[model samples]
Target: MSLDTSTRGFGWRAVQFLTVLVYVFMFAPILVVIVLSFNASQFGGFPMTGFSLHWYAKLLENESVLRAFQTSLWVAIVTSIVCTALGILAAVALVRYEFPGKEWVNTILIAPALVPETVLGVGLLLLMRFAHQPRTMWLLVLGHIMLALPYVVLVVQARLIGVKRVYEEAAMSLGANRLQTFREITLPLIMPAIVASLLLVFTISFDNVTASMFWRPSGVETMPTEILSMLKISISPEINALGTLMIVVTVGLPLLGGGLARYLARSAR
Candidate 1:
């Protein structure tokens, strides 16, 4: 028994060590970028020349960067809203009802995420061309919605699957209608998942580059694409500053959403 206990402890310790290593591997680059954003030197490297907020200042002063940032923010916000609404409806239909071609509908809805980004981007571009539609922000928004829909659907559907229908039935027995039961019970229960999906879709849309590249209109740019263009010219510390800010916003949002979800879940319980 002592030997078995020792083996299990060792296994746990090993797992903990591996988990730490994985986190370090994932965050090491972000750490480097954050550090370099504060570096006084223009070039990024180890052994910082000094500390300064010059790069961050430059980031604020750069009009193109600001424009791109705004563009990305706008797209992310719209994508999140549209995707969340559609996702909730789709999740409800898929989970609460059975219809003809349900399987095909589910497959088609999620197929965008399964397909390669390059292929999807190319196809979208071709479709737009064939349809004689001019490239526009709406097109980019549509692309992001397509990309993010599957994730939102999956998250909400998973939450719905674990939820008991008895709550709705109980509400109905108390003289509540379908809409009333949903608003008072089902909606509150699913609020956490919806919030989580909104935050997740926002992040995905903001960070997307490959698919956005094809859909971007002339004279328009997203932060990711702007960063790519800047890199082709030269790596600037300002990019690092922008990246650090993005990391903060992206990481902070999901954390905020998680906290909100936890509170809602506890309150619902």
Candidate 2:
């Protein structure tokens, strides 16, 4: 091997090593949580305190966690649906049509994602106070929608931009109405992006804490809020169990959704 070739090979190997190290650093905490979930000890630390499902059982039995989980689930579901619907429409319009101040409109639509979450949360709280609207699940839902909408719009819009107008125009030339063209051609073409947006919005809403912290009313707690309260009180193995379950669901659902999207895309082709 030449000297220059050996140096280049060493540089590439160093890059690969650093990439793996970065991944390990990011995932190590999650791996620890998964491992600690089965720890029999009440505390969440090392030393292999014997494997047991005690915390998982406790997580199941905890009414607070169950209620919080339910709240988070419904909020995420509603936020995803609303964001996806609005996002698709906004994305389609933004990508397909030109209007006066279109750039400004696009910026406005995506501004929330640029703003700090804490700032948004505080601003929402103030708006609620000024309006005399009580903090409630609906309020939280709206806040989450605002937070997730920009991401949904950006994702779906990027996909829409990549799509050719020829497909839609061809459908229209065949005497298909705008609605029919959209329903038959445009929607399917963007299904993967829509699916991705749904998963992203749902995950964001479900795992939200900063906004939920400001907007959650009395007697209402989302899973993230519940976890925060638990931490404030004291750490327990149950928290680890809860974290593990959340990690599984969050990672698993997106994978499933992505696979389904891929299958649908293939079928459409």
Candidate 3:
């Protein structure tokens, strides 16, 4: 090979190495938490601090933690449902229609995803105060829906683009109305993307601390809040245990989901 070509190849290889290094750097903190979760030390740390499941055991009996978990779960669930439904509607309208101020509507729907959580939180808080609304779980759900809507709309829109328009028109020609065609045909075809987007938004809401913090009332707390308070007063080994369990569930379930989806697709074909 020419020297110039060899030099170019070396530069490309270096870029790949740097990209991998960046990924590793980003993941290192999470890896450390997973490692320290198994540590026998009262304080989670490095340097082979032994191994124990005592922290995990404590987590099982922690009522406050369990309550916070339940609250987070419900908030996420409610937010996911509301956001997904609204997002799907908005996306369908945006994709199908060409009307006045259509681009403006699309921009508003998508703007939330790009804004910082803190900015959204503060803005929501101010809006609530101006409208005389309380900082409650319902408000939290509303904010989360707003936050998750953009993601849901974006994902569903992309999936919708892949669907053939003729399928719906065919259904319509066969005496099926718009509602019937959508319920029977369009929804099922884009179901995978909807499900995936819902799960992702649910996870985002459950794991959120910033937005929750801004919107929460004095007496209420979520899992992330509980974790943060625990860390501030005293670093608990139980946090590591919680972190480890989350890692297993979030990381492992997605892997399992992909495999199951593949298996189902194969079976269908």
Candidate 4:
């Protein structure tokens, strides 16, 4: 018994140590970038030459950066809205109804996520060319929607699975129609998941680089593509500053969305 207890203790300690190391490895580079973003040095690299917000100030003054940010924001907003709406419908159909080829439908919907971004990007570019379609903001929007829809579907579907259909039945039994029942009962229950999906899709669309590279209209730039351009030119502190801001937003929004989802889910229960 003592031998078993010692072995278990050692195993637990090893797991904890490994977990800590994993976190450090994941975050250490991000931490370095954050520090460098605020560095007073003109260069991006480190030797800790005091702290400053010069790069951030430069970002504020740069029209191209602002324009790219606006473009990214617009795309993210549109992608989230469309993805959430379509995702909700798809999740409802998948989870709440019986249909032919149901499994196939689900697999098809999520296949884009399973495919490599490079392949998807190239495929999209080729398709556009084959279709004789000009690369446009609309093209970028569509690509982002395709990439983000699966996540929204998965999140809402998971929530829908946990939701008791009996509530909808009861609402319908109370003389509510199917649409009415969904609006009054089903929609509320799944709202947290919808919100979470919206935020998550926004993050995905905003941070998208690979597909955006292929789909973006000529002479246009989103923030991610803009950063890539800047990197091609030079590794300025401005890039680090922009990166740090993106990290805050990309990391913070999901956390906020998750917490909100949990709180809302608990309240619904």
Best-matching candidate per TM-score: 2
Write down the TM-score of every candidate. 0.93, 0.95, 0.90, 0.94
What digit string (tens of lDDT, one per residue) describes model 4 on residues 18-53?
Answer: 999999999999899999999999988978799899
lDDT by residue for model 2 (178-197), tens = 99999999999999999999
Assess the local accuracy of residue 195 in candidate 3 as a C-alpha lDDT between 0 and 100. 73
Candidate 4 structure, TM-score to reference: 0.94
Residue-pair clashes per candidate: 0, 0, 0, 0
lDDT of 1: 0.93
| Model 1 spans > 4 angstroms off | 1-5, 8-19
lDDT values for all models = 0.93, 0.92, 0.85, 0.93
TM-score of 3: 0.90
For residues 1-269, write the lDDT of model 1, one tens digit per residue. Answer: 25555557777889999999999999998899999999998786666899999999888999999999999999999999999999999999999998999999999989989999999999999999999989999999999999999999999999999889999999999999999988999999999999999999999999999999899999898999999999898878888998999989999989988999999999988
Pairing residues by index, what is the TM-score of model 1?
Answer: 0.93
1-269: candidate 3 lDDT, tens digit per residue: 45665557777889999999999999998888888888888876666578888889999999988988889889998998888999899889988778999888988988988899999999999998899977878888988888889899998999889888999999999999999999988888777777777787888888889888998777788989989988888767789899888778777766776676566435533
